[model samples]
Target: MATLADRLDRCYSGAIYDVMRDMGLRPGVLPRTIRGLVPDQRVAGPVFTVRGRPDPEVDAHTSLLEWTGLLSRAPAGHVIVCQPQDDTRALMGELSAEALKLRGVRGYIVDGGCRDTELIIEQGFPVFCRYTTPVDIVAAWRPEAFDEPVTIGNVTIRAGDFVLADRDGIIVIPADRAKEIIARTEAVIATESELRRAIRAGEDPQRAYLQYGKF
Candidate 1:
């Protein structure tokens, strides 16, 4: 049998969202402001959460420590779901992305700006962020915590939750519920596939939806 992670790797964010909703889970989706740096890049992995904010009190030495610490701690096969409370600085760049990739980290979902996007895209690293900027964290930002619950848009994301992202958007499924959700999502996909075939054969969409309960 395929693992939940493997099954989820084959699932789309939209299908996963519907499955989660059917499970009575909110399907915590990051806002539309975030988008993939590389077109068609998709990521599915357990999240390693990071939360940070702008702190005017920090100086050069402390800033160096902060950046290095966050970068070094991310484990392999995990998506870095970062919440940088201050949106001015670019929290991710080419060099950091390179390190994460080498460490086997899957991708990034940042609720802040990112820089060196051209190089990041060139490296084929999947990074979804609010925007791109040339500004950096040297002057005013520091990591507050990691592996902690953080909110993005209206969603509350906890460390270890599964993150699935594509051009559509990013969605977080609670870690404990991922397996069940994936199983149901596979069934949902089968139903959708059947519905597609019916529609192509000239079946009315309304009738197909009525028969399949999905369109």
Candidate 2:
């Protein structure tokens, strides 16, 4: 049987959004600032959440070690969702992206900044972030927590939740409800496909919606 991640990977973000809304799980999309660097790249996986901030007491040496540890321990087939409280510096760079890819990390989603845009794009490692900057977390930033809940754009994401992202946007599904959401989304896709066919065949919009109960 296909895993939850595999099943989610087969659906686009729009369908997932519709299914979640129909199920009453509102506020699923991440902030508009977080966009895929490669808009065509679609990724779906379990979330490995990280929450970070600039610490006045954590020295540079210790901060580096802490950040390194967090990345090194990222589980295979997971997407790293980070909420770095500061936006002045990049939380992810080329080396980190390479390491995550080597460990089978599906992709990254950061509600902050990222660097090494050219190389990251060339490598085709899917990354979604607010923006890019040359400044990095060498001095004061450190992850305060991992594998915990983090909020981005009013959507609370917890570790083990499912993330589906594409050119349209990113949608987070509650882990317990992911399977059911996927099943519903498949039905939605099928209905939409048929609706498209009917419209192209010159069927009236009102009749189509009446027949399909959707349009």
TM-score of each: 0.94, 0.94
Tens-place lDDT per residue, model 2, 56-163, is 788889988998998888999999999999879999999999889999999999999999988988888999999999998986799889999999989999999999
lDDT of 1 by residue, 87-181 (tens): 68899999999989998898988999999999999998889988889998985799989999999999989988898999798989998887788
List the candidate 1 regions with Cα displacement exceeding 4 Å.
none
Evaluated at residue 172, the lDDT of candidate 2 is 94
- After the best TM-score superposition of candidate 1, give how far the Cα of residue 125 lies from its true spot, in angstroms: 0.6
lDDT of candidates 1 onward, in order: 0.89, 0.90
List CA RMSD, all candidates: 1.5, 1.4
On lDDT, the candidate that comes out on top is 2
lDDT of 2: 0.90
Give stretches of model 2 more than 4 Å off. none
Clash list (residue pairs), candidate 1 = none
Report how far residue 93 has shifted in candidate 2, in Å. Answer: 0.5
Residue 117 of model 2: what lDDT?
A: 88
